[model samples]
Every structure is written in C-alpha cells, then in structure tokens.
Target: MNERNRTVVTEFLLLGFGKLHNLRILLFIVFLFIHIMALTGNVLVVVLVVFNQSLHSPMYFFLSQLSLSEILFASNIVPNMLWLILVEGGKVSVDLCIRQFYLLAAATITQCLLLAAMSYDRYVAICRPLHYAIIMTFTRQLQIVIFCWLMGFMLSLIVYIFLDELDFCGPNIINHFYCDIAPVLELSCSDTSSVELATFLESFPVVLIPFMLIIGTYISILRTILKIPSTIGRQKAFSTCSSHLTVVCMYYGTLTSIYIFPPSNNSVDANKGLSLLYTLVTPLVNPLIYSLRNHDIRRTIAKFLGTL
Candidate 1:
C-alpha cells in the first residue's frame, strides 16, 4: 500500500476456468456453442420486433431493447472468454480490461432500468387494461426506452470513473472468466474500501429497487388474475406474465446472491457459476420462453419460417 512499494500492473492474466486447463478445448467448444445460440436467438427476436409490424407493441418494443442489451452484454465477455479458452493464454491489457468492464456495466445497468420500465408497462396492461393504450402510448414508450439507456450510461460511467482511479500493482490475475468488478478491485494495490462500499450501496438501487418494483407489480397482477371470472381469462392473464416473471426471477436470483450475500471461501466458483447463469443461460432461454408460450409470437415465427 506504500507509494514506495507501489507497482504498475500493465496487464492482467484472467484465470478463466484455470482448473479446467486440461479440458480447455472442450470448454471452448461448449462456450462457443452457447455464444452462438444466445446471439442467434436474441438477434432473431430483435429482427422480428423490428421488421414485423404485428409485434410492435410496447411490450415487444421493450423486449427488443432487452434483447439488444443482452446481445451487447454477452458479447462483452463471451468472445474474450472463448478466445482465452481456445488460446489458453488469457492475458489482457489493463486498458482493454477496463473497456470490457465499462461496456458490461453499461449493458447491465441499461437492462435493470429497462426491466423496471417493462414491469411497469405490464402492470398497466394487466391492471388498467381499458386504459393501457393511452397510458403506454408510442411517445411514452419511446421516452421510457431513452430514459433506460441514458440512466445506464450515466450510472455505469460513474462507476467506471471510480474504477479508473484504482491502481493495480502485482498479482494481476483475475480469478474469473471476465473482468468483473470484484476480482479487479481485489487486485488493486490502492485502498478499495470506499469504492467497494459505493458499489454495495449502489447495487441495492441498481438491482433490488427494480426487483422490488417487479414484486409489487406482480403481486397486484396475481391478485387481478385470480379475480378473473372465467378460467380461460385467468389462464390468459397468467400467460402474459409467466415468461417475464421467470426471466426476472432467474436474473435477480443470481445477481442478488452476488451482491448481497457475504463473500465465502468458495465464492469464486459460486460467483463464476452464477455469472454463467445470467450471462449465458438467461439469454439462451429467453427466445424459447417467449416464442413457445405466446401464441402470437409462435404463429409469427412459424409464418416467418414457412417462407424460409
């Protein structure tokens, strides 16, 4: 911690799946396949929402934004990870690591804001069905989307500014597949208590604020569903939410553990696995969940594919 003993770390060695060195080739193949699936599926959704006028509701518009964020988010890490796994030399320059971290943070923050807006949209649609169109008009929807992206940029830029000041000295080996905040901060030669505290406090608002909003909205949504007079109406109401709820739970569940829970002796592996869940598994499943469960999307996809 002394200025005299301070060292400048020019690069970091990402110890990505270090334990699986012997199986690097296999891991590369698996991750590559996941990357392909996630990218293709999410992009397909974006494309459909863009070109297909029938799917251009407020819900689908928000969804396209989410899909685009996922694509950018996953790309920030997966491609680098695959490169590391294939080459088995995961060294990255400090500047490049910071860039990756910035992009990742921006993408995630954008998603959090976007998801909150989406939950509110759903809340209006289900709770105030008669006034849904007027409430969530094109202009309002566009405003929410813009606000989400702007907030994401501003919040993440603040974090990145703090991170940029930290000095990484020796032992520049990040114990994760990607340049995440915790690992990179841990390796900093300078004191990181303030930054760590800031991250912890901000994470609550960044993650749990949206999470709680979703919870409150869904509680009302569920109550409304139960009050529906007919069984088919109940089922229809429930179906509208089932996919988003599933994705929300899965995304928040993993992230909540990462930020809120006490770090443990085995936290590295646990965090790594959790990262895989949100980064890879979530995107991979999103397309399937929406397309399969929603009759309109299913029919649209079917008609689109029939042309191919």
Candidate 2:
C-alpha cells in the first residue's frame, strides 16, 4: 500500500447536510425543535407504558422498548448534527465516529428485533387469543426484550471489532451528517471487504429475517381477522393493528431502500436523505402513529397528564 493509504487519520471532516449549512442557524433551530419533539414523543410513550397499569401488557411492553430505542437512535445522530451545524468545519475524532457508528447500529437493530417481537405478540393475540397469555408469559416477554438488545449490541459489536482492522488515511472527509457505516467504509484505505461482508451477514438477519417474520405474522393476522364473523369485531381488530402496520411499512420500507438497494453512482447526499428518513423521520412519526392512533395510549396519557 502507498504511504498515503497507511497514514493514520486523527479526525474526520463531516460535511453535514451539505449546502444546508448556508442556513446553518435555521437548520440548527429546525433540528433542535425536531430533536426535542422526538425525545418528548418517545419519552412520553415509554413513561406512559411504565406508569400506567392499563398498558402493562406485552404489546405495550415492546412498544416501550421501541420508544427507548428510538430515543437512543435519534440521540446517536441529531445532537452532534445540531452541534456541527452551529459550528464551522464540522469534524469528529475517528474514535468518536466509530463509537457513534456502533451505537447507531445497535439502536437500529434493536428496533428491528423489537418490531419483530411486537409482530409476534400481535400474532398470538390475534390468531390464538386463548394461548396468548400462556405463550407470551412475563418470562418470555423479558427474554424477548433482552434478546433484542443483546442481539443488536452483539451484531454491531462484531462489526466494531472488525472495524479496527481497516485503516483510514488522510483526506478523511465523510460526506454525510453522521458516521453511517457505508460512507465511513468508503473512506477507509484498507480492504473493507471483510467488514462489509460481515456487516451484510450480521445486518441481514436483523433486517431481512425480522422483516420476513413480521410479514409472515401479519399475513396470518390478516387471515385471522378476515375469518371474524362480526363487522365491529373486525374493525376493532384492524384498528388495533393499523398503527403498527403503518409504522412497520414506513420503517422497513425506508430501510429496504437504503440497505437492500444496490449502491450506485448516486451522490452521498442522496443516500443521506434516505438515512434521514429512518434516523430522523421514523422516530418522530412512530409515537404519533402508535399513540395518536391508539386509544388506550391516548387515554393513559390523558389520565397521567390530568394529575400533573
């Protein structure tokens, strides 16, 4: 390798949001508001789920986990983004960016597994109502939740460990808001094939498998709902699921576009937009989609707020 390819890079230049820096103050204000809103929305869901006796079910349990993951997910990127936009020459240490990548991946995979768990919970409730309580016991719920977090961390940890093998030379400018795995890989002078392959192997299970499971579960759910004899019963069943489905569609849909789509000659700016969809938009929308459409959550929030 050329000496240039082996020189150690201490820091990376992060071109956040590209030309949007022309309106840096405005963008910072906008993202600050977004960060606050995302935190509030997800935190409220988690708080409601924890404090309210009514939402102490397995579904809400998973929802609370998802909310927490959303908080971490957005936190992994947004604050730094706000900080960078407020400053000139946005940059981060190599160590900091790698850590950020680890946490971001963990948050993302946790949500994916949690969503799958939620889908399974829905399946049990909808298709086998009698066996729901028996199957989704407290031990099982805790096990599933723990598994999601551990699995998420473990997968990202694998990638992080492997990341140490790759070397970044000078000209270490990352053309995106955050240290996204792909763009960061593009900067490495060392062979990233192993890490890329490992990332794909690890990410595939979290992304593809959980998504497949969710789809299968929902298919069964749809069939079960169709078999219901009463229109009101069907409406109630559909209402219970419509929110989750909407969020799932949006979440997985955007992720599929970002991950599964073959990387092209498209500008990094284009890919950043896709990242914004999941990293920013999904977290904010999840609470609105799940809570606003959810009568139980709405009532619980109202009751909790009324006392305060």
Candidate 3:
C-alpha cells in the first residue's frame, strides 16, 4: 500500500473463462457466431430504418439509434472477448483497457436512456395520439437522440476521470472478460473510496433516472392501453409497445442481475455468465424480438428479401 513499494501497472491480464481450456474452441466458435449475428441483425435494422420510407416514425428512428449503440457495444467487447476466450486469457495495456471501458460504459448508458426515450414515444403514440405528431416532431426527435448519446459519453467521461486518478500497482489480473469499473478498481492500490463514491453518485443520473423514466412511461402506457374498450383494440394497442417492452425487460433484467443484485464473492463465474447474456445474447436477440413480434419490421424485411 505504500507509494514507495508500489510498481506501476502497465497492463492487465484478463482472466476470461480461461479454466475452460478444453472448451475454448467451442466457446470461441459460439461467440464468433454470436458476434457475427448481432452485427448483421443490428446493421440490418439500421439500414431498414434509414432507407425505408415506412419506417420513418420516431419509434423506428429511436430503434435505429439503439441498433447503432448495440453495434458499438458489441464490437467494443466481443472481439477482444473472443481473443481472450481463445487464448484463455490475454494481456492488454492500461490505455487500451481504459478505452474499452469508456466505450462500453457510453454504449450501455446510451442504450438505457434510448430505451427510456422509446418508452416515452410509445406513451405519446398510444395515450396522446392526436398530439403525437406535434410533440415528437423531427427536430425534437433528433434532439432527444443526440441528448442520449451526449449524456452517455459525458457520464462516461466523468467515470474515466475518476478511474484515471487511481493508482494501480501490482496484481494486474482482472477476473472478467473486460475492464469493468469494479474489477479494474479492485486492482488499484490507491485509496479508491473517492472513485467508488463518485461512481455511486454518477449511477443516479446514468442508470437510475433512465430506469425510473421507463417505469413511469410504461405505467402511463398500461393505463392508456387498459382504457380501450374492445379486447381486440386493447390487444392491438398492447402489441404496439410489446416489442420495446420485451427488449426493455431483457435489458434491465440482465443489468439488474449483474450490477444491482451482483453475485456473491464466491460466484464470480455466475457474474461472467450474466455479463455474457447482456453483452452477446441481448444484442443478438433484439432485432429478432422487434422484427418477429412487430408487423412493420417483418413486412419491411419480407418486401426487401423478396426483391433480392
């Protein structure tokens, strides 16, 4: 703990499920497939939103941005993760690790707020249909999407600043796939009380606020949906937001499991599995959830595929 005894930590060894030596190849293949599929699905969504005239609503616009965030999120972690999986573990310079941390944090925060924004869009569409056009104007939609990205990057910058101040000495082994804030801070010999405190405070705006907004919007949405007299009408109304709701549940469920109710100290492996769910699985499934459940996306994809 003494500054004089401390040695600068130039790099870190990511201890990605390295113990599964016999299954490394299998893990690599599976993840590679996931990475490819996630990228393709998200990219297809973005293209669908951009080029298609029918998909120009605020909802699909927000969906495209969400796909963009997923692309960044998945790319930031998966390639290096694949390498770590294949090699069992790998060394990364402090600088590269810090970059990865920032990217991952920004993408995650962006997606969280984007989901909240999408929920609000649904609330407006279903609850205040007459005023939806006025409220969700093109300019306002752009502003909202830009604000999400800006907030995400700005909050990440604050976390990075705190992390930069920490002093990491020896024991540069991170027991996860990526440089998550907690695991990275664990290696710090410096007093990380300030960093931890700052992170806790930052979580209010980054995670808590967006989650609360999503909850509030959905509550209103449910009330509106319930008010519709006909069962068929209610079914149609609920179907509109169901895909977004599903994605939100999956997103927050994994997040809450990993960060909120984090596994016990002895269950680090479980933590990794949860991380994999959000990082790889969610992105891969998001497009499927939207396209399969929603008629617009499926119809658009069918039209596009038939032309090929």
Best by lDDT: 3
lDDT of 1 at 132: 98
Residue-level lDDT tens digits of model 2 in 1-308: 65442578878998776677578888788778877998999999998889888999999999999999999999988888877777744879888899999999899899999999999999999999999999999899999999999999998999998886778884798777888787788888889989988987886799889999999999999999999999999999988889888988998888888878824746666787888777877889999988789999988888888999
lDDT of each: 0.84, 0.87, 0.92
Angstrom error at residue 84, model 3: 0.9
**Candidate 3: worst-modelled 10 consecutive residues by lDDT:** 1-10
Q: Candidate 1 lDDT, tens digit per residue, 1-308?
A: 65476669989998778777899988888888988998998998998899999999999999999999999999888888888777675799888898898888888888888888888988999999999989999999999999888877787877788888888887988888888887888788888887787677777777878878988999999998899999999988888888888778777776676656735847778788878777777778877788887787888888889999
TM-score per candidate, chains pooled? 0.95, 0.95, 0.97
Pairs that collide, model 2: none
Ranking by TM-score: 3, 2, 1
Give one clash count per candidate, in the order shown: 0, 0, 0
